[model samples]
Target: MILKKHLKSIMSVTLAVGLVLSMAVAQPNLGMAASADDETYSGKTPKYVFMFIGDGMSYPQVSSAEMYLGELSMPGQITPEQLDFTKFPVHGALMTQDSTSFIPDSASTATSLASGKKTLSGVINMDETKSIAYTPITEALKEKGYKIGIVTSVPITHATPAAYYAKVANRNDAYGIGKQLAASGFDYFGGGDFDQKTGPKGADQHIYEIVEGAGYTIANTNEEILALNNKSGKVVAIDPDDYEAALDYEIDRADGELALSDYVAKGIEVLDNSKGFFMMVEGGKIDWANHANDAAASIHDTIAFDESVEVALDFYRAHPKETLIIVTADHECGGMTIGYSLTGYSTHFDKLQPVKMSYQEFDKLVKEYQAAMPSDPMLSDLADEIEDAYGLDINNLSDYQSSMLEDAFEKAMSGEKPSDDQEKVLYGSYSPLSVTLSHIVNSSAGLSFTSYSHTGTPVPVYAMGAGSELFDGFYDNTKVYGKLSVITKLDK
Candidate 1:
């Protein structure tokens, strides 16, 4: 009704008319096209889109990261080599149920992938009878002037980047989705940092002081996002430091930090401008590593979200007729299946690369060893630190994985109150020793899991630049908002 009560004043007058049509065009050096035949592709009108997703990705989490990157290829590569958004040209498969539920949460499948509208289940872009809110392909391309990024590895007000600029009816209400993502005067907002970043406890205003009093500009390390440029101003990096310090589990990041394709190449170097930007990224912890079934941290967060879908397919081969992209997901968590029953059909995905880290960093290494030995913490001294962070072979366990880790270490040292079969094998999760050591190293690399949550399975979309043949065949994820509202032309 009247654009869902002026969704925060239509993002403060569409970023004040996108800084006067981004200072009248002309500034697209988009970089990265040195040699895919020195690229150039032409098609127009899509005017730079994107819209990835991946929160709980499926199709067996993209064929289990293309069979664990084909067992980490390169020694005479016979296979395992399709990533960069699963080599899309066009592909389809959706049907992620939700209006109430059919296993779909990530705020009702990210508000039906940002306002294609199907609502319910802790709505965000409101609609399944909440008296109408919908209109969210980034606010219908912010009234056609565009420019509105929103990357995510998690927590840019969660629920899949707050369903492209909040309209909250309650997706965990992080202080009212951090005041609608600090008044969403949109331009950018990379992920993580705010599940409660100074809001839930003794709250006296501090979502970083209302996202820096709404003027924006808050990067977060990697030297303040590589000393941002591209006429920097309205930003929101948030590369962790609270909200469980996210942007993690790209096989547990280190060194400079900030990854999720460095927040989509710093959100395409500050939303590429010239009235054309509608980003959306996500890869949101591949649904918290399939809610802890953790197939090698959801295949290293789906190959670190295919390095931001190969940085938006190298800016759609340098604006292939004004970009389009797409990719997909928002459903199918641990129904993930890649054949296993102790290797009946064989699938040694390099034994999930010794699981380096993440069952949320072994659930913060079991609360840092129960706060350094809480009155003597020891589940076989943390099961020998999960067999040295998952190289497991726990002296080759498999008498049903050492009797389910000795009945999960005598029901986690008999703290009592946990028997529904020890709450479905360990406090229902938050790292029960990295989910019993990554499901016994993903059942010794043949892999398995049916549910810890989310699964009505379908997810897989792909697509490519301009009008991607309106997302070929099989539909329903609200027809990806009517084929991205006719490839973002925005007349609807």
Candidate 2:
């Protein structure tokens, strides 16, 4: 798991330069100083804008990833490690509450981020009443002739990406969302396939047909996606191997597989124009991993998300003055904490390195095992599998830990439903054995989760390049859209 040489060099140069600047100015190397004159930022607009959303990311998620990388790079010692977006020249915090409650889902939070307005949970780009649609900044920019691109590790029509264009009362209306995506006429759309291409009941028009009829070239294979260039015109590129679901987690990604960074890099090539462009790239599966309470999987996805930010940073370096990059999250998920009671005050993030795949992937392994075995398998039967997948030594488990897994294994084997309360404590709607295994492994690494759902935590925002100073103050998530509006001079 060596860092790519080019990305490593980019990070080194940025860190070195930031250190020198900090020494020269006698201030912390966190962000560039804001000017006292309000007029200094007026009428300023970036020609190239990249907005990166690490879905379900917050301080805990970011810090754990940094610490994990630090441990990997320099074991047995404490050292500062930073992800690329964290090195930006502006830093801020965002309150994630929505109209419905303090704790929010992606639909509402993303709506506030995109439209400068509040909405009920599960609503997208509309007011709480859902009667009036709010024009998001992406549509505004598109109206002004800037090419727009939407990319995500999840299906394009998912809540976060849909906030940019699709307006729906319910986020689950994937068919309706797909129609809006086609009507968006945005320059590029790349990610997983539509979550629901033919409506929930399979009675609606195919999403692919709508997109093609709207003049988009669909690229569903690696070769087709790779061949897409600036001249490819309007395109929709999905991972050919996993067309129906999210791209694989970074920990599970294989050699030559397409990644979030690859999509962002391709987006820049296709969206670049004289009038400039705006690209929204989402690390969508970080949230999914977090929801499953898989620390190793979430950490790896967060790292992959940072690498996607690095792609934008590379672009920023080439067009420093004209480019603006903003990185933030919709909300925090999993209530992930760095220290666990079992480990007391010490954390050993390096312990997570041995984990080989995501809980989603491991669940598949469980299914395969069940199908192949002639008889019911015992907890002992999965020793080698558990060791290989989660770095757990089943034989070494304490009696209490062993008991918990044994009970879960029995429930999994019986194929009987557990009570809702039991489900929450044991699996939270995922495969029972998989969730239990992650809990065991995470505790070993001094990591734990408070809940298997979203938390009422505010997420951090990082910005650099043109108009980045405007993002330096703490605020509600709605102000994100306000700041971008002011930066780009979007009409109210």
Candidate 3:
């Protein structure tokens, strides 16, 4: 009896020991560089940080991009290319609702991410009452001597990017945001041109002039920016052509266009300083494309953002122990979901392969054609343009699709404006060609969108590198700043 009892106790002890060994192997040794065994960073503090914001990028957005990439695989290619950021060690769902409403706007959501607090819609860093104001993470880091870099695929003064630097009552206060961008006096700013050039209500001088007046060297071309030798001074580079308010969508960009990752690499080159740095790169056009219900365009822009992720990953590899990289979205726009009712359990994702130009480009194409052609041009003329832009076979189009285009073309020929309902469904633009083509392809591909505006769904968060373990588990959007503070030891 005594021997049996002793054997039982021994077995229990052996099992317990095995469990401990397994747990130790499963856990990562935080505060140490990914590739080093150096003890210099033996504590929970990051020296370098990167925060990537995919505007309107929620779970559906990420999943869509993944599946689309899968469909693009070549025949007999066993392993498809996955999104680079999905391999992050820590993942979480962030509740993006603000203090005021369930469906939050960009300004309020960005305010929550920028500061560890909730604020009203359209208000920058201030609370709903307009009395309590919070300093942004960028401002906080800037005060600590960390170099700051901001890059976006939209206007540098857009809501998400502006939340980090500008504090204002209204997001439409573009001129004010532009002035703040100049006066922020951080280190680097790269993206599209500002929506407003000067003052609160359209002042006389251009915004670039103010930025240059503040001692920033503005670069307009790829060669000019890449060859920049002025490492000590602040730099600002925006595309010189003011065609669209933001950079071109990746799907429609011309040859030799600078990609989102190129901007990220350039910002890193310019902002890497001795005191450390905090840089933000935004995939702003993902939200814009989703707003237009353009799945192909959104996926291409998401790929662009992933390329920027790769750029940061190379930097993280070199300084893994001191660097922290986080990728998330401020809100979920378009209420996207897979498995559309038309396809049930099956979908033809390759149907999206035919889409070429973006909805905006298609709208512009029709307008230009109409302006140059005679008043009573035949339907084949417009049909040929649509076929060319969308890869649609007009002969194969359903009658309903044909009628949709015919009515809209007739309206355009008569110079009639789009109705309120038409505008809401088609991204506030008059384009039956774009609407019909997208509907035909997207339905077959099993992609669907619930609304044209932002949804209250929680966005996904992916993080890696030093201090990355702190980002796991679900949390409020405001807690982003808190987690960042704890992980980086910003308060200490």
Clashes of each: 3, 0, 2
Better of 2 and 3 by TM-score: 2
Candidate 3 minimal-lDDT segment of 10 residues: 30-39
Estimate the TM-score for candidate 2.
0.90
lDDT per prediction? 0.75, 0.87, 0.79
> Candidate 2 residues 1-492, lDDT tens each?
356988899999999999998788732111112222232356458999999999999999999899989999989787748898898879999999887878899998998888877888999987767888888889889988899999999988899999998999999998899899999989999887899988899988888999999999999888999999889999999987673467888898999899999999999988877899999999999999999999898989999999999999999999998889999999999999888998999888877999998888887877887888748588888788899998889889989889989988887877766677867767887788989999988888899998888999999999999999888878778778767877877653
Candidate 2 residue-pair clash tally: 0
Which order, best to worst by TM-score? 2, 3, 1
Q: Name model 1 segments beyond 4 Å from true.
A: 1-37, 53-60, 63-146, 157-192, 195-207, 214-276, 287-323, 328-337, 341-343, 346-398, 407-434, 437-461, 465-492
Indicate the residue-level lDDT of 252 in model 1: 78
Model 3 TM: 0.86
Q: After superposition on all CA atoms, how large is the RMSD of candidate 1?
A: 21.7
Name model 3 segments beyond 4 Å from true: 1-42, 74-81, 229-232, 377-379, 411-423, 426-430
**Candidate 3 root-mean-square deviation in Å:** 10.1
Model 2 ranges off by over 4 Å: 1-40, 420-423
Q: Using Cα atoms with residue i matched to residue i, what is each candidate's TM-score against the true structure?
A: 0.35, 0.90, 0.86
Q: Which candidate is the best by lDDT?
A: 2
Tens-digit lDDT string for candidate 3 (200-291) = 56656888788889988888887877765437479887765435668899888888887788888888888877888899889999998887
